[model samples]
Target: MKWYGASQRRGTLSRLAPDGKDVKAVTLYTHTFFLIEDGRSDEQKQPHYTAVGATPEEAEAMAFAVYQRAMDCNHAMQQKGPMLIECSHCGIQRRVLLPPAPPVAVTRKAERRFFNLF
Candidate 1:
């Protein structure tokens, strides 16, 4: 997907490690996934983050995994959708819309503030 910032750009499917070692034909299989490596490591060899999938189906399942991982990695992460898919070949991007979160319960004390207006 077309993310708005440079950092987001780095998180695209194109930047993900291929399912295999073949550099020429890198296909994102079901197991092919990406992860946001922990950035706290002092050694450069330690991955800042990582994502993986075991099968094509797993890859699809991991879409949400990655999104959650990103959110967990950065609480400020604001994505338009809960899941996103990008085709490395044609550069097509699609997003999977998650069901809206349940409305929060308002406490009686908070409700009283609005009642005064009524």
Candidate 2:
């Protein structure tokens, strides 16, 4: 009835079901993702990055790693430039493209403003 995290790196929490089988619940924010064209055209892509990941620190590190790899692939491709990066799930390893990094939410302190007509 309850689940606990298996580890920090893994994004899963598991528990036993009524039938004595393992029920693995995929934890949010633990999947790795990057920006790529969604087949819209040759030069334009969807205006968003796919999201997934690990811990805050780990996720940032992973995203940066993908960026680095993409840069390498870009050099190899030459004129084709960049736009594809390797995916962990996909088997074809010629590689794919990745952009710099995913956008992060900005947190700021709220400021209360009042009319000060003196």
Candidate 3:
């Protein structure tokens, strides 16, 4: 997905999900699960998941951390700033503050459609 400009001073920025639909911001949050096997029942436990922040500062920190961790092994990390991260569980959306001047584009190419197959 292409990144857009920074959020509007802690406001909800409409973003398209991987499916190319207008999904709520909260849908971006990813959840980490822990397996807990009990004697009788097996259950999955989730301690914490990544989430966007209400303020620019908080959003920036979260986005930076995510970027750093993802590219730590490769050593090819790009700086980022306030971004919108969605909550995987609750479907809550928030503005995550990131580094200053995050890589984002103001516009994107229009989506192409294919006709019926022959």
Candidate 4:
């Protein structure tokens, strides 16, 4: 994504390719995984991953690390601050993107179109 007037990926800033084209990384991605207690069995609660990394893989690793560390004491619940990571390529580091906010309703039933259902 564009950041600070430069294209970036996984914390790395875009650099001019030999052909003068900007090199970009893969699109940032995220995944949801249920976090159970560090051990096995009996716990009915599962927490979903809420972290974003430069890449989906990175996001998972980072989020898991945070959860494991914060819950080291066997607490059932824990809160974590935003995770910050640096890119090895360009040093442009940042917190993962926050979850999108709910959209506001601007109009309701202005015109019910039959095709809209499809």
Best by lDDT: 4
TM of each candidate vs. truth: 0.21, 0.28, 0.22, 0.29
Q: How far in Å is the alpha carbon of 56 misplaced in model 1?
A: 1.3
RMSD of 4: 16.1
Please write out the lDDT profile of model 4 over residues 1-118, one tens digit for every residue.
Answer: 1112121123322334343465544445553333344553322233333456566678657655544554343433322435444333322223344568899888776776798783
Off by over 4 Å in 3: 1-51, 73-118
Candidate 2 residue-wise lDDT, 24-103, digit = tens: 54444442333344433322322112224545555545544544454334322222236533334321123345757988
On TM-score, who's better, 2 or 3?
Answer: 2
List, in order, the clash count of every candidate structure.
14, 8, 16, 0
Candidate 1 Cα outliers beyond 4 Å, as residue runs: 1-51, 75-118
Task: Tell me the tens digit of each residue's lDDT in model 1 across 1-118.
Answer: 4211112212213334556665443444432223323543332222122234444555545554555444434333234345644433322233445679999998775544666785
Tens digits of per-residue lDDT, candidate 3, 20-78, equal 56554542233222112233222222112243565555665665454334322332323
Compare candidates 1 and 3 on lDDT and give the better one. Answer: 1
In model 1, what lDDT does residue 72 have?
34
Better of 1 and 2 by TM-score: 2
Q: What is the C-alpha RMSD of each candidate to the true structure, in Å?
A: 16.5, 17.8, 22.3, 16.1
Model 4 CA deviation exceeding 4 Å by range: 1-26, 37-45, 76-118
Error of 3 at 106 (Å): 48
